[model samples]
Target chain A: MTMHPDVAVLARYADGDPGLDEASVWSVESHLETCADCRARLAGQIPDDTRALLDVVGAAVGRGIEAGPAPARRRMAIRRRRLAVTPAPWLTMTAGVLGCAVLLHAIAPDLPSLVLLLAPVAPLPGVAASWNRRTDPAWELVAGTPSAGLGMLLRRTTAVLAVVIPLLALAGARTGAPLAMLLTPCLAFTAASIALGSLIGVRRAAAGLGTVWSVAVVAPSLATAQLPVVLTPGGAAAWAAAAVGMAGFAAARADLFRRLNSAD
Target chain B: MRTISAAETAPATYAWAVHAEQLKVRAGRHLAVDGLDLRLRTGVHGLLGPNGAGKTTLMRALATVLKTAGGELTLLGEPVSGRGDLRRVRRELGYLPQDFGFYPRFTVREFVEYMAWLKEMPKASIPAAAQRAVERVGLTAKADAKMKTLSGGMVRRAGIAQAIVNDPQVLLLDEPTVGLDPEQRLDFRELLADIGVDSCVLVSTHLVEDVVAACTDVVLVNEGKLVFQGSPEALMAHGEQGDPGFSPAERGYSALLRRHRGGAA
Candidate 1:
């Protein structure tokens, strides 16, 4: 037969003393589980007041377990919280607007595929949506948090692109536009907006870049029925360079995002 | 490995939870918190001011939501400068904004738990800490209720739950009792009193009675500058014998604001 715990160890374990090692405490608890005499010894070591509090807490916990919500419902609630990281309203609205533009392309096949021409700027609104304080209801609370800077903004921007990129790809596939023409410029503009966003504001940068693309490329290309030089295969290298340079700029000035106020 | 408690990491023996030296924060072009130097320790201090007097701006700056345009601000002995310092300070901060926005679909408990995660609380401690905060705010029954379904007062309480979930060293609540009913307001004041004993709690409010009941000191601001900082009794002494208001505290509040406004004009 194994030996019982010493009186001193039992007393220290009962008192939850800092010096008591986990192995000794575990041994004492294991012994008490099977040995009635040791259990009695452990109980005697606990003060009456402490025992009374334990009884009260134990009874309350028992009652609570009986009355608590079912585990299934609790799990569902947890699952909902886990899945609650959906895109903001502005992002949803951007997708909706882009969907309408795609519909416009479908109706007018004779006209140039607005989807390909517009691909560069399609994700801009959604990217802006990810960081816009005025539009987000939880902005005040979220802005005050430690992680409420470029890292979080970029994460949300990635989420927006994750959804928007596939949509743009589908639009390009349907319209028979070259993938590089649509994809490279799209990434370049996104990077440009983010880089400039660090200087001004994300919302302002998106709106400004979107307007410039529309005027400089979309309108001219639409007028002549010829693809803009910037969207041509020959231009892919330039687009790639702009994207890399702007991305570097955005990373360098990431700290600016933290000081961006809603009022600004 | 011994798990260190939050108390050990953030010792309470520090001199001031908030220390601002000539802190200048701008809202637009105007300086909202202009050259304001103040020190706050661990206790409930009421911030009394009129509209547009920079109460919200000061709270926002302290919460690290708005950056200081000029001067120095330190939170919990950590200087509020550079990215690393800001992150360290934010880990120990809890703020309830004036608007207190939320996602309508998030359950009350989810909102608090999300805030705990944002404060960088350990993943294992978050669920239990969030639950305790919800219970403390008397929202146990509605823990599963979606935020949109809650009444204004309930949402306010939800906001309160999130602020305290981290057991922050510096807790800032701007107009926290606005939507709450009289009974809820009383309960909220008690919660403030309880937390005020340990942490530095600065509550900005228009309600004079709430401050008189719960605050150890009153800081009156007017036109983006400190008018007075003293005990409630000292503020009460400012009221004239024949001043017309609901209570002596209200009269004192009115008298002081009026006097400050007069002097500023």
Candidate 2:
């Protein structure tokens, strides 16, 4: 309170003139932050037209905030909303697909890693649909939202994987594949798809990675009736490292989804 | 090129809800909105254009759905070129795309409330705001009905409800009245007039009557360029001469496009 800005300086700030130096403006703003009197004086200097517009907007927003249902009820409603839109149908179908893999392993006990092959790929389709704007009916609305970036996509992907992963674990238990073989490679592929999906769309990334896995590992393993090096215990550590690395890569490119084209 | 710092309480000269300068937008490889300049204040501004004239693309750019190919665009005083700025602008903006989509399983109320949340509305304020918006669109009775059960017109109304649920500072609706009946269209017009009192509302449509009835101003675009921007009277003035359309407004619209195309040729 020892010193105050000049009236002329306050007036210049009020009018939005470009003549005021940035340093002086910053000093005045910093001073005003601690000075209620200056703040009031500055508010008084706002143009009548702008003040009126602000008043109208303020009233509308005030009414909006004051209104609405009770918070507890709203929280419950939001929970129900999340439950309703959680892509349960697709997850259920994925479980059915996993069930088929389990049945295939039981029928051909000697078949080369039937469940192991299916386990890694089972979550791909569901994970792909979980975040792909094209597959979701509400994609237009969801994609345009402020939360439409990688955070939202990761949330949906996790939800899809949550359902599919456990099913894969159960399938591996039936097929006699090592737990490390089923879980690590499955997570690795999911993370890799998302990492690549950050550049291309998730659907294309899933399809491409799925095709590569089928050709590189699944096809070779079946032909030779021997476990691939990458699917063995030693490869588990590599898969674990890849999952962390790919997830980190996906997080770094989060902004890519924000500006993604609608068709993507 | 005036700059208003975040800390300054200065009143800007433009005071526009949306401002674009030589903005270029693309749909795939083709330029949709090419070198377009537009400024809108607080009012219902109707956007009139033919198919592929870039109205949707312009709307999408404004809504932050599509990236600008070139030039500058601002919404609610925030430049949309930056990710942070676009996120802040989107919080205060509402948009209903032409092909508005929704989850079939979500009830009407849940859908609107979810949109409010996505727009970052306060959790407590969401239910009432959503209820009011639903009631405004005459969907109070069906608030709890799943989205898939609603007919086409009802679905469109639901779309409108979500757009206005947050009482956004800038509301953009693309072909909002497409499936609405005559009576419903009238109701929608009245809603536009009511909301236009404070917020900047832009409606993009092929229908001229809606523009004449609700919009304070009309912008006509063709071939990704603005043909005219003025009052409906000025537009109708152009059609005063021997014209072939049914209504004066329609004739005016047709005449303006023909004149622009002729000039381009």
Candidate 3:
């Protein structure tokens, strides 16, 4: 049997006195947790002010426990919130642009395959989304992390492709654009942006590519109402080779992504 | 491997967790941090300077967000110029920007954990580490609250929480007390002392008193140049009755800045 705390010690403990020492206080508290009689005796020894404070705190805690969410439910809530994070908004925006392109092509089949013209740059937004310091609020924090290098960029870029490719394929199917032409150009532009992005930054690279593509391909195609030679099977093959070349170039210069102040 | 932790690698004055010599960093075309030499060890260091003095730029350079345009920069005994060394150094570094952004929808716990993951902490240890960090910042109750729901001070605390989530060896915080109330700033001082036991903490702020109260040493910079480096008491020593400030530290700060400006002029 353990010895109970003496009357004097119980009184000192109830007063919240530090003179009792941490060891003595710890022992008394541990004993009181298991010994109801000690608690009962200590309850009488507790100062009235302290007792009132305890009642208020205990009541508040009890009420809080009753009203608060269950641990399981809270976990589920966090899981749901995590889904809407990172690249989803960018992915959705890209999807919207593709949708517009598909609708435009359907309304005006003579207007030179908008889907085909725009497919190459479809993944650019999402690919560049996570890397931009200006647009991304968490850029500084993310940049400080160890894994925030070329590997992370590639993973995010791949995720963008996973969502975009399917959407591009759907748009192509609707607009009657060939799969090779639609998908190949998409790969070429994404690779080129990332390659050039290694030097200028991903967001800038994407924007530059998008602008040039619109000027050289989309705008001209719209003006003349004719799909350029770049939209052909031979052109698609050329884009594929360019995709491989640009990807290789990006890989060779992976060292650039590891540096700071590249305006990332 | 045993000898790698030896104290001899660094110069006699403390182990330099962050060391910069003649370092130049660019902010666009401007050289914000120019030819500055500084050494930091395992203690809370207060970085003090006037506006545009390059305190934030220096902090950014230390955080490795900006490349050193020239000179030498070493973190935890390794030169920061190497490619492979960056990842290892980054894992040991923590930074809170002057004005940070958060994913509004993420809960405080989620954000910290995400940062831990980004720092590449082991999967199993992330949750516990993140929780400990949140608790340290006194945000246990608000751990589940979304970032957008937090007040400004709470957001600042959340930023500090994420910065310390990995228990970084080199923690850089710029203007951390900008939004904090007096009481919260007091808590932050205690947290800084606790963390500074083994880590090198560099806190940049306009609040001179906060520096004098919490920091082991004061570093005053002007125009990308290091003007002063010494103990807080030494900083107070520079102040005279005529110097402008409410407290000794503030007067000392004014005196140092005045002297530096006078010299430059």
On TM-score, the candidate that comes out on top is 1
Q: What's the CA RMSD for each of the models?
A: 6.9, 11.2, 9.3
* Candidate 2 interface RMSD, angstroms, 1 decimal: 2.0
Model 1 lDDT tens row, A62-118: 999999986753344342343225454655676676677678878877767787788
Model 2 TM-score relative to the real fold: 0.81
Q: For candidate 1, please provide the TM-score of chain A on its own.
A: 0.67
Task: Give me candidate 1's TM-score against the actual structure.
Answer: 0.83
| lDDT tens readout by residue for model 1, B95-118 | 999987787878998888878877
lDDT of 3 by residue, B1-265 (tens): 1123453344534368888899998887999988999999889999999999999989988998777889999998788844554887888888999988888988899899888888887777788889999999999999999899999999999999999988888999999998888999899999999989878999999889999999999999999999999999999999999999999989999999999999999
Pick the DockQ winner.
1
- For model 2 chain A, where is the 10-residue window of minimal lDDT? A72-81
TM-score of chain A of each: 0.67, 0.67, 0.67
Q: Candidate 1: where are CA atoms >4 Å away?
A: A1-112, A262-264, B1-13, B81-85
Residue-level lDDT of model 3, residues A171-195, one tens digit each, is: 8888788899988888988889889
TM-score of each: 0.83, 0.81, 0.81
Q: What's the residue-level lDDT of B167 in candidate 3?
A: 82
Error of 1 at A235 (Å): 2.4
The collision pairs in model 1 are none
**What is the docking quality class of candidate 3?**
acceptable
DockQ of candidate 2 compared with the true complex: 0.40
